[model samples]
Target: MHIGITGASGFLAQQIVRDALAHGHRVIPFSRRKGEPVTGCEPVRTFGPDIDLSGIEAIIHLAGESVLGLWTKQKRERILRSRIDGTRWIVDAIGKAPSRPSVLVSASGAAIYGNRGEETITESSATTSVGFLAEVANVWEAEGQKAEAAGTRYIPVRISLVFGKNGGAIPLIKNIFKSGLGGKLGSGKQWMSWIHLADIAALFLHALETESVHGPVNGASPNPIRNEEFTKVMGEILKRPTLFAAPEFALRLLPANEASLLLDSLRLIPEKAVQTGFSFRFPELRAALSDVLA
Candidate 1:
């Protein structure tokens, strides 16, 4: 399999490329910026013809700006534009290709379901959250739908908070812990769905090969833990005493009301992943944390 991936420099994207190559698949990295070359593929910009994705077996679209920044109006616009605009370029490229790729494995988010409180969301759940990220995720999923309409097998991977050593939410939380300020937010009982970066990268390979899994798929662990549980386990893993807590008011001082997302809860289950027989490498929070910490 010669996989063509966008955002090859991104944390998740890079992991996908590495896993693809390690599995004996060649990867063609599609990028808008100049990045260190990937081992199995050539790096080409969105407009360049140097790499033709038509020849590749699959396309994993992950190119987008980081969404964790302070949500100023300008920052929010950039977050939405990066995914919506970047996806348009990818769709256009796929349309013009002489031979369309067999599988289009694109990224989506658990955030698409928005803050459902105690509602356990599946792929079919309707998203009614009125926020910038909710809207961006909706548009992001639509971009991949275009490829599906074009007769390509499309898989929209809606990933949850991926916790790993170097990147994603865990490192930031680890840093806060290292700084002696690690604790839970809000009531700490808000449900938080998370996945190990290892499990996330592996899902790309699973979805790439598994014909049973397509359309919108959840990339979270089947076990969804509360924020308090997460804080406790993380504190244990790092051998630090978890003591402090940040209230909702403190977070509300930040931009875009994104603090609500941090403080709110969503209990997401990987129903499709489990039903389709895709087992998680790190199902429990402690095990996942230990593996990443180790």
Candidate 2:
């Protein structure tokens, strides 16, 4: 299969591209910037008009602005527009293509489930949260749905926090622990849904290859850990003591929307992925972190 990926330069997308190539699939990478070129793929700039979508069997749309920093009004618009406008462009290009692709595996987030306290959420769960990021995810998935109208099998992957050694949230958290400042955030009761980098990449491939899988798929591991437990695991893995804790008030100092990324609780479960026979390489938090750190 020939796969086209948006945001191919991104951390998770790079892994997906590598895996796709390993599996003998041709990749055409599209990005917002002209970065170092991918060796086996042509880097396309599609922020402007008309990108060629011909001969691509599948598309994994992952391009979006980073939602990690301070969410000022300007930053908030960029966060929302990047996903909404970027996806719109991709959907339009796919619609106008000489031939439509077989599948459209677009990126969404587990944040859509919002702060559902202790409730374990599946793909069937309602997106009831009205938080800023949750709203962004809702709109993002809606844009991906437009491809289904064009006869393309659209699968919106609601991804959780991705953990890897060099990238994703693991490195940043590891650094804090390494510096002896890692500890629980707020009440430390928030549930964090996370997936290994390898698992996420494999899941994208699974979505592309699996015919019966469609609609929203939860891209997460089966085990969801609480914030306190996650912090303790990080400390234990790094052979460091987690004595320091960040108070809720200190976190509130960040832009309210940005802080919500940390404070919000969501126990996301990948029911659809598991039901579709996709196996996670690192289903447990300790093993996943150990693999990355190794």
Candidate 3:
């Protein structure tokens, strides 16, 4: 199968592209910039609707600005525009292509079900939280729905926090723990829905190949842990003490209430993925951490 991917340089995209190549699939990376190479994949520089996607069997749209920075008004706009406009661009490009890809697997987030304290959320859960990210996710998914006009099967992946070595949130947390500054954030009672980077990549592949798995699929593990339990597990794996707590007030000062990433409780469940027969390689937090840190 020939696959087209955006955000080819992102941490998750790198792993997904590598896996796609190993499985005898051709990966053509689509980027906004020109002349940049993606190691083993074909890099196609495209702007707006001019993207050439002929002969592409599928597309994994991952282009977006990182949401980790301070949530200034400008930064928030960039984040919103990148996903909403970026997805619109991809959909428009697909509409104009000679042959539409069979599947469009676009990125979404669990944050859409904002701040559901202790509630287990599935793809069917309604959006209850009000914030920037919640609004962004709603818009992102809405834009992805446009791809269906071209008769393409659209699948929106509501991804959770992906943990792995050298990237994502794990390394930063590991560093904090290694420095003995790691502990539960705020009250540490919020539920955290997370997935191993390996499992998230695998879920992407599953969505790409499984025709029956359409619509919104939660990219998370079956096991969702509380913040305090998460701290304990990380501490146990690293054999370090987790005594320092990140007060909520300190995090609010960061961009987008950067602290919300730590304080908000989301008990997300991947019911669709499980019913679709997708198995997670690291469903347990301790094992997931050990593999990432190893």
Candidate 4:
């Protein structure tokens, strides 16, 4: 398969590109800058509708602004605009392409479910949760859905907290725990859904290859852990004490209440992936953490 990947420089995208190449598939990375190139792949530098995608079999759209910092007004706008505009550009490019890609594996977030305490979220779950992130996700997915109108299979992967070595959230969390300052956020009772970086990257390939999978797929493990349990596991893995806790009020007082990203409970399950016979290599948190830390 010839795959066209946007945001090829991103951590997740780089993994996907590597996996795709390893599986004997051709990868063409699309970047906004001309000089930037992804290793071992031909980089196409363009972002507008006129971008050439003729002969690209599938596209894994992952370009977007990072949402890690304090959610200031400008930061929130950038997050939303990047996804919305980026998806729009890709969809438009698909429409204009002489030969459109068959499948579009776009990136969404599990935050679309919001703070659903104890409720297990699946692809069928209604996205009624209201928040800045939720709104961004809803809009982002909606934009990606436009490709369906152009006779493309649009699969929006609703990603969870990604755990990986050297990238994603794990490295920072590891440092905090190593310093013995890591602890549960708020009451630590909130459910946290996570996926190993390898599993998430593989799931994208699964979606690209599987014909039965469609629409929004939850990119999370079957076993979701509570915040306290996650903290405990981190402490054990890092051999550090988790004796601190950040109260909810204190978190909310932070700029733009970015604490919601930490405190929001999303018990996500990969129902569609499982039903379609996709398997996760690191389904358990402890094992996943061990492999990542090692």
Best by lDDT: 4
Local distance difference test values of all predictions, in order: 0.81, 0.88, 0.88, 0.90
Model 4 residue runs over 4 Å out of place are none
**Candidate 1 lDDT, tens digit per residue, 215-269?**
8888899889999898898888888888999887898787677886697687888
RMSD of each: 1.9, 1.4, 1.5, 1.1
Which candidate, 1 or 4, would have the higher TM-score against the true structure?
4
lDDT of candidate 2 over 1-294, digit per residue (tens): 889999888898989999999999988888766667888876665543566788888999888988766688988899899899888887898889888898999889888888899998998989864989889999998888999889999998999999987777777787899999999999999999999999999999998899989899998999999999999998898899998999999998886557788888989889999999999999999999888877
Residue-level lDDT of model 4, residues 27-103, one tens digit each, is 99887776666778876667555667878989999999999877788898899999989999889988988888999
In terms of lDDT, model 4 sits at 0.90
Residue 155 error, candidate 1, Å: 1.4
- lDDT-best of 1 and 2: 2
What TM-score does candidate 1 reach?
Answer: 0.94
- Model 3 segments beyond 4 Å from truth? 47-49
Q: List the residue pairs that clash in candidate 4.
A: none
Per-residue lDDT for 23 in model 2?
93
TM-score rank, highest first? 4, 2, 3, 1
